[model samples]
Target: SSDLSDEDKIDQKGIRNSPYFKPDWSPELLSNGNYITHFCVYKNNVIEELKGFRGDYSGSQDYDLVLRATDKERKIEHISKILYGWRQILGSAALSTSSKPYAYNVAITALEDKIKRNGYDGKVQQITDTFFYRTKYEYGNPTVSIIMPVLEDLEILKKCILSIKKNTTHKSYEIIIVDHLHKKKELESILGNNCTIIKFDEKYQNSKVYNSGARVANGEYLLFLDPNLEIITNNWIESMLEVGFISKVGAVGCLLFNNNGQIYHAGKILGLDGICSNALEGRKHDNMYFGIANAIRNCSAVSGKCIMIKKNVFDSIDGWDENLFQYFNDVDLCLRIYESGYRVAYTPYVKLQKQNQITDDFSNEIDQRKLFIKKWKHVLEKPDPYYNENLSHVNGGYFLTSSPPLPRLMTLLLEVYYERIDLQTQFPEVAEGDYSNLLKWVINEGIINDSYMVTLAPFDKDFEILLQKYSQ
Candidate 1:
């Protein structure tokens, strides 16, 4: 294929192990750089709807058009078979984004237009010195109820309350602390006049406590927050509301890092490790997992730790399923939200420090998994749409397979794990948005073993030359 083409390399932006795009993977996953390569054959009507391309964004005319077209949820397909060659001529933005510097600026304008059209009051903040962006949406100042289930560490509860009071700029919110009936005196000492303590007589049950807090919540939106989380971003609540405001998006969650600063929760995958697992768990947030950890995207499930949703929508799902007890309660809640035709969403604009010192009181983990399996076996049986079917079970579930479904030079990077220096993350900034740095991070820690990194990697004369060009 490379011999047939003017260039000897595949499109770095589309160097994915899987050839298909997630249905409706736009506004969040879609950006100016990756996956917007030229030679796209579009339906005439779709092109006509966007008026083809604008002249104002000359360097990135197609990028602007694609952003505008996909803004309204148009289904896009990624055809794997190569249909044409792309010439990487000198001075072309494709060869080096710096060659046409105005392209990145035009891309920012294009993203801004997309955000404004979506009814969200947000500005697209470009990642400095890079073509990537993160949209910050303003909170409309609607009333929100903050539900804190106090199961452990009254000390952490104090920090959480203080963080909300100190960092959160949104004043139109009420903090409802659900806890043991006997701990009222102690809770009052910490919260004082800042929060309302709802003491219950029953033992600690996350589902029950969440439902109880929802029952008494008076705000239009309900934020199910764990008492162990400390807010870092000032506009955390507002940022989440940006995604929550999207049509058909039922629940919104934010990125939560553990005390050590590693990502513990960004979003949930239904079948990542087993039934479900955290997305990009234990990995740093900078440019990770197809940039999913930091991007505003649709996910299968969002964690209950920092999730926000409309009151009526939460009630529509009848709140959490009380039978599950502890683990997977959030996953089950998200699945039901999906069954009701609403997308569970996640955003990285909000960052929270997770305090994991406290231990949970519940111990019905085995039974809960059974309940989850019995209820959603139909959904779990399928591969997680947000994750690749060709990925490995290790390295946070973001590594390539030993024998990738579709092998390429990127597979050469897969043999080695994180033990070696990671070129993928380090080299992405080499050419910014040109897909060069993007390709380097593909194999990452999984480097080649022996003569082959990917056991099934092609070894023809052309393939060897391709390997020689990228082996380092």
Candidate 2:
């Protein structure tokens, strides 16, 4: 913006994606901060009716105006085109909130005012070291059912329960441990007065285990967690409830970290490396990669473990899918909620340290994965709406993609189409990969098995990114 010239405006897009800007217009988006002011237009009547701005909150006047305007209406849409540029000069708010510390409290005031106007008993607190804010609500201190699934690892459960009891500030929550192997008396000995136990026999890990736990849930919200996680954030439930209370959000998840304090699950990304996986695992738990780690944004899915959902929403989905015996059940649940017209959100406001997961065999998960792909291929075959198509899953980090979406898809199609054919020398410049072999193998598979996965996974997310990019 300092170089707001015609040529510079043309090149403004260079710093436009990731860690700088992403297009989100939901009330949840504005609740954290304003993304609607730069190079934006509004109806004169709307602005006038909202009473332009107050000099009292001069440092964050733009943010105040944005909150007031958006608070009036949530039916908003994004144009998905770059029309603004903000300069990150010294002593300017654009260089992060530290540039003008006064703006921080002003933004909180604006947010709390909006929350108060909405008839919610909530308080907004800024996330330290970042510009983002998190809202925590009382709602008369509703009980939250903490449903955790575990094996016979009583030691892990004990450590986790003790941590929860120590760290959690919200007292009105119950812990329901759904055990596959019987450990009732032992579980009772370790847990506190509010704890309940549910026993079940399941051969493999999946969301179905939560069904029995849900039946016994006495709380207004259901918190599905893994027994292996050590609770870190004191306000985990309140943070989740803040987002879940939003009428449009079905579920909320938080930043789950390995013992090393690295990100384990912030959310789920569909079609990463031809499979669905946790979001931003490559980044440290607190690393502000494009501000994604802290911001509460809609995700394609959040981890079923460490996810919280309203009891009503959980029942509406008929609970977790029982068909999934092992993998991707969490994603299936979130996507089903998404299909039913609700958003899944991820927040870093609540942090938990999970025991390191040792996936000795990626091959064993393939069967459940194929089933997951078949069941939710519609969503999988399209680019994740929450994940930016311009960002890539290379080297397991969300870095800028080497190429744009369209060309990437075209190149893949050419690769698959050219894999078996003797066309490599014909197109000397074309990049080569295993795409044609995959297509051919899939075709042969369809011929042999008659009609399923071969056709299901051929285009994969490459076509997904292409369609989403061009369609938008």
Candidate 3:
């Protein structure tokens, strides 16, 4: 048992929800290493291996030590239990980050050194004035062809093009707009001398329109964008290119927000209601749950509204499924891209604005969804590698489900059994002597259906008491 003062116990509640306690810590986790600085306990032997901390980095000595201690072979394990507490005394650096601003700089240095040691080709930069940092992957500049599909909304198209021209910092790019159906002179005027507008005199299909644009694209990469989108981040193109140019990455997507600043698309998760839905839809752009909304991670699919892929990769996949036409073509294309041995990644650094509308013609959308399910039935049956099993498929977001824990329940049972067997442990016996039955009852009643309940179950007193009681 560790000493936890009254104040420490109060602070531990907040720390438990942070990214530091996230389940795994791999090389990718280390690359984005700013979150692991607080409430950590390093072994005496591991500290000795790092030859103690440098006095020069006194303010961020713990951060430096943790970085040196964990490597690819010897990674850090995050225990959900709070075994220790941090006391924030007056004038202590922990009490106030402003007390020693030098620590921030040293922390950045430590991250840079760690990246070098791990052979990660990236640059670390402080995110605004905050202690949080972002790692930008470095790859040579490649010309990108932006393929935008539009109907006849010239005003919206003009805004989208203007935003891209004004906000985009990447220089090596060309815009190719696929004109579908209505041919407005305003669209031609909006195209100006910069863009190449191609006419498609056929039925409106997003996949075919994009494929038509891709055929004439000369750039090394293809950026499929919706003309209704307003670019929010100046570095959007640069950020997408950084991830898209990677050999292992098939496609990269940015966070998309509606006009009201609510999330429209963060990433696409498959098997949600037997089709694909945007991960973290209708949430704030910065809502950090399991660090999925904020961190760079692989996903099965991303919204084609604003996704980038290598020109060759698109060609290899034979472009999108023309049969999908309008809805779920992005999902179909992304799944094929994944099957073709390439990872699809979503990054929060680049964000865009668009007004998304769920189609009222449910029958047509449902028909397209059926075609999608028919094609990828095998994938829907399996667990999504990018998403956790505990998360719900009932909704688009990563909400927890009422499904029984199965293997996870076995681990929880072992923990409860060991606690009861330990004589010195303060752990109370099941109030009614049958903990297994209580767990079963709780699952049956749907008490642990959501993520909030599951996360707090181990520490929540009422929850623990409920688990201890036997059901009728």
Candidate 4:
């Protein structure tokens, strides 16, 4: 161990030439396998199985083996320290080696056959890539107003602000704290001039409170922060802001982790088994979505903990609906934006410290039911005809509701005089696209049928006017 001779020098060629020499992942990747070293020192039953078990697959065989062993018995203690080593023995790609490819094929076939035996459908598409932030900063940093609506959790709120102040790479920003539903005394002492604290009656609704703050926000960009959330990394604001700069991006959310460091939200997965959980749950920090190092992928919707949008976008959608007090607000906003031909995306660079967690200790049935009803009314009643049951949220809820009047009018105007394609030349491209898509989606969702077509002409002028105002 004390050898300091010249012979002890690491072979630079070996280090540099090795195919597996990915500095970012090599250290942690080797550490995950270090437990093998302790096998010689301690006699363990589990070690015996691991040694005996034929993990013949390539690349991920060890990882899969470990997973299998853990699933059998979760009682094993995690060796948090680095103890094992994995050197560059071969290229990481399994198909590169004949034997390894055979092994992987066999493993995959076995897995598929097992799933078939268990009556599982193998038609699902695995999301291999995830949405991440752009490093180029193509949008350039714009002044952003970080609006936080606080109710309680003063400690976490302070931490949240501090994290933002210290970690954010984007320098031009201000924090607006909406102190409505909680005592503001604790918050008063901690806030700096960078922050503007607004007092309002305890409303308990984030939508309305956020709207109130947006009305006063002076920045070109608006970011919504929940009090319980804290920023976890540098460049978080920049990541979200870049997305906001995209003309079609309506909202952008980041990954969220709870107090325990477990992932609370990676990105929203719509149209999953009646409910959706974080994309990758309980994964160690590096083993997350982009793998051990860094990467980005797209998601359906980002978490509410940290969502950023253009100020114009916020106003264009009329901000958050005050009727939605607490829950399903984000989903509601996302749906509206999506309908308006904009995208709701999840980027990788933003890391939010999530505070709200579903816990076993407390019973929130009453509130939960209220939230469910408020959020999924379309799914429950199927009253809106534009609802496509297959389009997520409602297996049948989307088709039930009737088309709103404005959308119907626009569609009829388009159909009655197909010659008026160049009509309303004053409207912007986005405005034209928005009106067209809203009409199309409403029709596609089956909200209005042929019988409902006659009433379109009367409101065409009004619809165009509103479209200009909304999309401007």
Candidate 5:
């Protein structure tokens, strides 16, 4: 059913009447939970297989059926056109999700069943509302070694340590502070007998320092944290440990907030700006997008600033790439973890405040980015499965791209032509064919102007001509 108002219906066609109503009901998308509300079609056989909708879940019977139908390995089609009419009524379940509380309860059971069927060792818990839910993994209490790489910022480090001591509810955790050079007596006195400070004379390399701390870490889990972080959530360590101890989870990260309460680190997405940074940085930590910001979910990579990994999993990966000293070492390690068939998870429950900002030299960042790109070019080229393809790659925060591609041959041709660095370079995969004459004509005439004014007649005619050639 369309949620559009009367004004929306008059000014712009409602979703039911819009031409752009086609949706891809891929298994991956369905597994993340359904976002669509109406215009569903199902085969008689699939209906029979599901044994029809359960009468117990009267309000969400259709949703229950949909979940059950998707659970099986069967083909599901999304009709581009809305073929059914959804009459609006006073007490329609579509309009009022709260009318029937039993439906929401049953829905939770359905989702939990799906999780169990999928063989994931996690339980579903309702979020703020019963309509939305999140998964919580069950991992026994394991000793966690919190590794903090610190420089000379004693004040910030002291606050960080104090916050951990005061706020953290999780016991059986040890703090291993890797001191670089500025090992002050005050810092030692502050640490006292609580933390084991490892002094290193080598120049500051984030990866090397973490590796050094891990070498002496006796805990089952290794938590790599920055000295600037102040623990905000009481069960922060437990939250991270729960996800980290999952057999299939290689690494788990927490949501970090800046002084202004803006999101500092909330997992990460690879292939963004050649290297990777925090996904959805600068957004309010609680601002939910498709239930992502509010739930525990899998990601391609996560920030190392407050990430935890099982000791064995860390050892298996041989620790962080020291070559990627200052930057992208975390992303690289997470990528390796992904390649090794373990998922990287991010949970918003464990929130932390980062007091100090870690600034990197511009030139050094560029160099690090180049190294990261060179090593993971193939992964960069591929779409991040955890992230939506429609989202812009240029922005770390998931935003819709301006001037999205039109489903026209000329638009594709223009895109391919623009992608080419030089005339000699091969065209994009979409425009890969022998169009020597068209290329020559385009090169000679330059159909696309410097200011990108598309006089479409020439390109359109050339595309048709090429289409005719390819058709033969």
Candidate 6:
């Protein structure tokens, strides 16, 4: 903007511009952000290539400009609010309006060029998905073979593949599609140069298809994906790859979106409300980084829809248990990974939009009460998973404990049931005496409340500080 001459401004003003100019925004007004801005728009031409642009993108010129500006050495004021609106009117040249195949061609060229430009020592040919940017020394990028299980949906699967071929930042990868019962002609026509199709005779089961793909995969890392999802960004592979490289992270997953473009899965909580619920079930993209197409975080488990695992980790864990057909396959994998002493992460950054999503499909009304009781029968049993009587309510660490929901609830219900049964009849000593101590511990820890430990008791100052810090 500083390069514009006074004469040029005057000429534009004379042509059609208004006399009044917008006030220069102050740095203070933009501070103390109540909201996070999606991205800052830089003043630059879309088609013209700027000098010193870190990466080359014939089509994503605007994107490169914005990225460059964001990484500049200035106190780039975070416009603590949505400052501008880019109005793409109907029939305008919106990016998606372009022909899909043409866009794919442009995106592929730009991606390969960028990858080669940013790759380790310019060795683009060998760069794998697992090779995130390393600062210390260049480590050998172990080849990662990704096995995607394809069903009969050729169109959705094609979009997924095109998205990857165009946007993927890592190139040292192959797509092996285990077409477990699909039309031969459609599958053959769509399989690209970089992908292979394996036909299986049996009926389609997700775990079995993935296991079949892993048997002949030649990469150092293995990535599994469901075909009904579209890859959205270049960072998808790299994001999971970085997480997978961490010693603690056994598996990595991305956020899933419903057809409406709202969030479906950020990650699943292991034990919440008697069963695991995918966190952030229905949240809108306020243009913040958290719900963006590719924000990464540590999570309980990656969804089976899309997951990345190191080859060694996969083998050591004995791969997917074909016993788990589909629904809990991902959960079983995560639990196995944890049991094998590895962490499961949920990165919101990487994104895939689920196709044929039943986002609003809760039409059938099932028995809510009966279902709830049956689900928590494990918790009603003997040993509680999270009911530590020793730890005070002030302790904030119970959420991370290994107590699965069912057993914990089962233990509580039995204790209360037995206590009430003995109240009327002179029954045996049925109530577990330890329940009092455990209840007290749960109450004090703030899991449950009791009248016994009211504010009437004097508290230690040291204890107060410790509790406050943890609680906060």
- Cα shift from native, residue 389, model 2 (Å): 1.5
> What lDDT does each candidate get?
0.67, 0.68, 0.66, 0.50, 0.66, 0.50
Task: Assess candidate 1 and give its lDDT.
Answer: 0.67
Question: What's the number of clashes in each of the models?
Answer: 11, 3, 0, 23, 0, 25
**The 10-residue segment with the lowest total lDDT in model 6:** 26-35
Most accurate candidate by lDDT: 2
Weakest 10 consecutive residues of candidate 4 by summed lDDT: 1-10
Candidate 4 lDDT by residue in tens digits, 1-472: 0000001111324442211211111111221221121121213566576573454544435433443344332333222222333233454231133434444444444334333543433321112322111223245557899998775567777777788888877778989988875566677798766888888786456777898889889899888887777777787777676545655567877777777886666555433222222445444455431152233333444566678877877787898876655545676676667666676666656787765663332233234334444455343232122111222232211122232323323333443333234333522342434554444433343234432232332332345455554456
Give all TM-scores, in the order shown. 0.75, 0.80, 0.66, 0.50, 0.71, 0.50
lDDT of 6 by residue, 1-472 (tens): 2111010012312342111111122111111110112224344542243453444454444433433333323333222222343233343322123422332334334334443444422221211221111212133466778788765557888888888887776767888888766666787787767777777778776778898899888887888987778888665776667556654567877788877898777665543322344655566644332122233444555577888887888899989877655455676777678778776766655788877763432222122222333433343222212122221111111222232223334233233334344321432332432233333333355222422222212221223443343244
Instruction: State the RMSD for candidate 5.
Output: 8.9
lDDT score for residue 45 of model 4:
60
Task: Flag clash pairs in model 3.
Answer: none
Model 2 residue 123 CA deviation in Å: 2.7
Tens digit per residue, CA lDDT, model 2, 1-472 = 0111110122233454333335345456568766454544566776788788888988888788777776654444454445566665567666556788988898899988988887787888887887778888766678899988775567887888888888778768898888777877777778868888777876645566788899999998899888888888787777787788877789999888877766777777765544567777856654555477778887888887689988888899898988775677888888889888888888877888876564434444546655776677556546665555656644344666556543433432442334434445534434443234334433444224633243345455444454444444
Candidate 6 TM-score to native: 0.50
lDDT by residue (274-334, candidate 1, tens digit) is 5577877888768754455666777788889889988888999899989975888898888
RMSD of each: 12.0, 5.8, 11.4, 22.0, 8.9, 17.2
lDDT of 5 by residue, 45-87 (tens): 7777678878776655666677777666565544433345444
Winner of 2 and 4 under lDDT: 2
